[model samples]
Target: MKFQVRCFNIILLVLLLILIYFFFYHLRYIDDDGEPIGTVYITETRGRLDKSILTDYVKDKEDEYFSAANISVPILVWWTPFTYDTGSYTRCNNNNQARCFISNIRKYRDNKQFSAFLFYGTSFRLYDLPLPRHDHEQWSLIHEESPKNNYAFSFESIMNMFNHTATFKRHSDLPLTTQWLASIDDLLDQTYLIDVKEKTQLQTTENLAPIIYIQSDCSTPSDRDLYVKELMKYIQVDSYGGCLHNKDLPENLRNPVETMEHDEILKLVSKYKFTLAFENAICTDYITEKFWRPLKVGTVPIVYGSDQFQDFLPDNHSAISMLDFTTPELLARFIHELNVNDTMYDSYRHFKLYQIISNDTLLARTMSERKWGIHNDRVRGNFIHQFECLVCERIHKTRQDPTIKYQAKFDDYGCPPPTTFDKNGEKLERSGNWYRSYEFTRCQLEVFHELLDQKNYSFTEKDINNAATKRFAPSFRRNEFLR
Candidate 1:
């Protein structure tokens, strides 16, 4: 009887502990640091989080908003942007997207929850610089432009909506002015390139050595092709594997078609002499992961980006470039000679091994920094905080709005009705109704909230729920090739 009693007590204790653990773990609440913040949550569905590029984006965004333990409002991100109702941040045509944003705000003014909104994109300069900001008004608007070059600027048309003021300046402007504002540093995935395991699995002597590679997509222009062709001519395609241009191929040149599932490309790099690392456009800081993939697989990279490469890369790396060799024939001859001479060939491999070893410390440090403490401060000033505070303020105000109808049938469902045309009182169905409507998951709505909250924009859950349903449906004109 005593033993039974003890067992019952033990089981009760275990269950109690579990209950306590979950209760605390599931609770989401705000801290009191007063930083304006938001979070963008990428969906883990489709096993998409495994890819480095997408993972880096999500990590960078989270770190940007939630850093410094600064308790502010939280905003969640959804992966598929098309499904969510952007609320006031709708994407109209490329030139008219900003106008669409303005129009959305006007349409939803009666609903106090959606007074502010935030939208991020790469092409800020093209949207016509110098956005509007109001002074010391709660009904004011705020906009943030994140340029592709790892930097952003904030303008507050509504100054009262911000806890702290954000200043705007140009890239080429004075150092003092630029320094006064916060610097938007990139949350780099420092472990982007690591690991150097050599593979011994060899099937054939011809396929033994990996070939140098360059893949040009279908969208590349003729001028881009000319540049690639010129580089390929210099790299000596005959000696290396082959230069790949999916669309246009010369008769003498054999097409280099790679299998999608085959790590053959990576394997080619590992066993090959060197991989060509040419940029699609020079002077652009968008460092494609192509440069690091070869290095991660224990292969040498011949790089050709801007001087910014030096800004981001380590010094004294032995990677060759278009600037290094005098001519294509000379480069080809050198590569051929290295292929025949085992000593010279092995020396190149040793250089690659040394490169990997040299960057090991940096790689580990970057990974740890990303994992902890890096996102400890919020950089968007107090805009999000103020907006969230204002939202709470509005919610209190609306509770007393005697004229406000809380229970109104909103167009929440995303499904659109068929369009009809009338001629002489006869209704006719509009042509081209085959296109489907867009769908949104719960995760997307959370992200849209954060993005708008960053702009000090507020909208109701109903408004957000409605906006999440618009899909990216474009109709081609009869003259267009697609049509």
Candidate 2:
């Protein structure tokens, strides 16, 4: 009887072990999304994203499983920076899910050992030797300034995060550079819109001053100071901050430009009719917050630097272009007229009524000549959050299939040479009209008229006479201009 009881207990134990094995196997191999399940081992040579941040990102994104029958489980494996020994794969080998390794070519010379390798652009230099494309799949990722920082890697695929069209190539034969473009054109989309009744109250508030310019960068490649100085001669531009401090800023607002809070700066700017929005460098599609801020605060932006200003603007009347007028005097005259005429000035504010569009839609429309539907599905957050999330998603997709390959050549993805100038400081034409093309001017006017017609704003002679009664305030005018 004792021998029979002992045999029964051993059989029960064996059955329990079999049940545990089947449970894990079924969970791993289950097909929910029709995608494969596999682990993506990412080992960074130079640390970019913090380990904690990467861990959190992966955990959040783990819901997206890999699609393949062989890949039963999807996992993201990362090596602790500085803690792991680079020469040995003992740590990686221990994990069954460790499929690929991303490391610097210079640091890790043994390319044949790893299943995959990823080369980061910021750390890459032209002098660095080419990474050998052995059995492993090789990929390049770049988000740095191009042309100046060129790479000679014969990558199977390249991922670019720049503000130009994906097909825009400096050289014809250059390989494909995929677009992961970044821009602040979605600022208005993120803002909560006021009701139609409340919008009238917001619009009725008068702009007390003519123009305001707050800049700390006195020296720049574009030499924006010369243009500002010339415009000041004709119009009363209240110069604040370190660049040109003609007027005393409030005691609370006397801090360094960088340290100043966004709300405080916007409060000061909202009092003015116009704001000088000039960029430091004149690069293609390289617009910054200097252009966006004024539009957000209901002030007309007198934009400079970017020749393709229309691309960024909601419409032609959204902002006054420095390139539109031949000289500073002409631009100043236009601003002065707008300041004196209330009806004309109010016309510029028509963009507030229309829904703000995203940069993606704008680019699509410009490239395809057809009106692309507004991008309502854009991820709303800070640039870093959106950018890192995209990178993580792409990495997962690439790791799922080792057969995927992309070609990104140096000349095609590189930045064009800086604009050449003549002896008189005038921009010289190289291949075509570099400044403002005729097509751009025509498009700007057409967009302005279209928006104007939508609003149905027609000013009669009587309306103009009534608007003339309310002139700009004396305090807002410069002491010399008032005299």
Candidate 3:
């Protein structure tokens, strides 16, 4: 009886161990959406303050921040912009530097041996990723540009892959929100704003078209050219640049490249009553020079991009929303009405004309919240170097105490699905390989998880593509986006 009882206890112990393994290794692997975002290890701590001021803390007290004991010299790897530029990566040139930087993956083929991997969001292709992402090594996202890789990074499910971010999204660990503006002063500057009389005079004398749209990249995700072409039928537009060219730039500004560099571009654009400030891609806080140039030059912007664009506006009337109008013809009709009514048109420049921003939130955020500077900025340091330092310092902290870990939330890097309109221009289809790369990318994670368990699994681009194509793409429904 004693022998039988001992054997029964041993059997119970074995069953419990199996249950725990299945629960954690198999079941807990799923994210909230029930999708496996692949293998993960996270080692970074979020400061208990807003804006994750730990980045600013290290930057502010550099010497003091480095003196902590048992902090490992973490090697920070930049997976893209493969060239090592002068930007500070770890402790530069010091033998006991806080971190090291590398591009040659073969040198450290044991992928997770490094402490952190930073990916340049714009250039980092979905097809080409540093796979077998280990939770022990923190991942950092350095993308302040548009969602050109919407095929990969758009969905919230992908955010589970990274632990740090320096993007235009306000919720990012280090927000590069004001990338387009020269400074906060640029947004609030009234120094160059033309008065009502001057705008009227320029419109009459310069033969200024009601709206000016000068663009070089004709093909855009927004399909802006189609809208502009349709708008032209309803209103008189002086379209120049490469796309929809109906007018020539001034003799000196003939070279579009040179015109971009010329200070006169602002002066010339300001003469127009409105500027079509269409963006290349639509994503949150993806505002670029297209939006800023007009606002600064005193031209009312007909803006298209960013579903939450109004958050960046100085006032409700500061710019026209392309989304507001059902069709191009209707938008043109409103523009015509605004042109005739100087009171209505000039109201758009209220913030600029007065140099008084009623929107306190814009002032508060730009003045206080943002950590990175714009335009190779000298004071706050460029965002790239700052982001590298952020990864380095956080890795050190996490190494010293592994309990201090933080994961980037969905909002940190999430973008919506990219879609292209059909021939009817009414329906939207997903943008990707046969409009299916997004689906393929999600499926690729399963591949990553399987490959991750293997020792030193280095995937060729061809290997990844074939596996994802064969396993996933065929299952996707054709011509229709996955709902």
Candidate 4:
């Protein structure tokens, strides 16, 4: 009787373990109408924050079991530009940065390690090659069968609609209307503004100092040592702000640039009158945090971007002056004139305070919306078009070439390609076994317009005017926002 009871207990334990395993592995979801929901096996964590948990799931022996929903919300993954230039896999390996920056898209596109990049951020240089192909039209696999009983889960809506070059429609759809003006105001409220009187009370009047700020770091891909050397000619040796370079500095330089924590940097900005704001590259409207930090800190931002700085400023807002003169003698002379002329100096300050004080509410709203994984409003609808092009190319090529196989490589990214012309002036064909590098640039725009026009998503002159009035105006050339 005792032996029979022990055997019964062991069998029950094994059954309970099996039930728990199935429960955690399954993904359950509802349709847009909110009726019946069903379950499918989800191999990876779609929305969880734990990096290790997702890593373990992906490392499983059977990669086939891990399936994901076809919710093609224009997926965005951001990383510091340094990752691509050098193998900084140490920092990348810590937080699944490798997957986010590089591998995730490769996995999604069903290629071992190749992705179709439509729009990348400021730093990474682009390669001029046709997109690569994978064996599977993995995009269609998700749509072929619904994971749940009642609802049809299709990536068509997400991939087909969002992700365009002209607009970041994947992010938000708040019409660039007068009503959206409040978003920028809300952003300023959350800005870290140190009370002036309180800061003064902490420091001695004797120890009071000037500030010099640096924007980009020394290790960045676009590091400019010569630009910093030229800037030193204008500002006093004692004043500088922002993140300072770690490279060697001259001995005579009395005060080095500040290297504060991000929060501490904001706190220090409010206490100083002058903040050094330089662009990493010339003639690019790629404005960084340097544009706003000074305004929030109540300091005069010594601007160092492009000649078009005025385009980004609000109408009649002062508190900014450009680095106009080229020669050090001319620059030094102008700096002296601005400092002594009290009335002229005061005029620039008029628009400076309101940029931060008045627009507090709007600034807060903008920041909150940018916080990741909040609302899926389908801001733009071009990402899906690009994915569809890739999907079709993959399927079409497989039917043509039977022996094609996927190979992981880094050759396509960092270096520029050799000259396109062959000895006879015709373009050279790729040497790969499969035509993975098949060109498809001609028909993409036509397909995009067809889908958008079908959905009645037309942008009129009124839409352009409304967008310009609220947010910055769209510049076809710069691709950066200018007000």
Give the whole-model CA lDDT for all candidates, comma-separated.
0.34, 0.45, 0.67, 0.34
Instruction: Report the C-alpha displacement of residue 102, candidate 1, in angstroms.
Output: 20
Q: RMSD in angstroms, all models?
A: 18.5, 20.3, 19.8, 18.9
lDDT of 1 by residue, 310-370 (tens): 3333324545554465544555566667555656555544534444333444333332333
TM-score of each model, in listed order: 0.40, 0.49, 0.74, 0.41
Query: Considering lDDT, which of the candidate structures 1 and 4 is the better prediction for this target?
Result: 4
- Per-residue lDDT of candidate 3, residues 120-142 (tens digit): 77666655666655658777887
Candidate 1 worst ten-residue window by lDDT: 172-181
| Candidate 2 ranges beyond 4 A from true positions | 1-209, 248-261, 353-404, 409-416, 419-483
Judge candidate 3 against the unseen true structure and give its global Cα lDDT, from 0 to 1.
0.67
Per-residue lDDT over 1-483 for candidate 4, one digit per residue giving the tens place of the 0 to 100 score: 999999999899999999887754332132223322222212211232334433453464245321232322222211211112111011111222222112222233332222233222222111211122223322221111101110111112223322222112112222111111223442244355444444344335624333345443432212233444554555552333224443332343323233332455566566654565654433223344565566555555666553445544433444454446444346545655754554564455554434543334332443344422111223322222222333334433444574653321221111111112122222223211111111111122233344345653444435433433433222222432211
Better model by lDDT: candidate 1 vs candidate 2: 2
How does candidate 2 score on lDDT?
0.45
Per-residue lDDT tens digits for candidate 2, residues 433-476, read 22222222223333333434465345343443333322222322
Clashes of each: 31, 7, 5, 39
Candidate 3 or 1, higher TM-score: 3
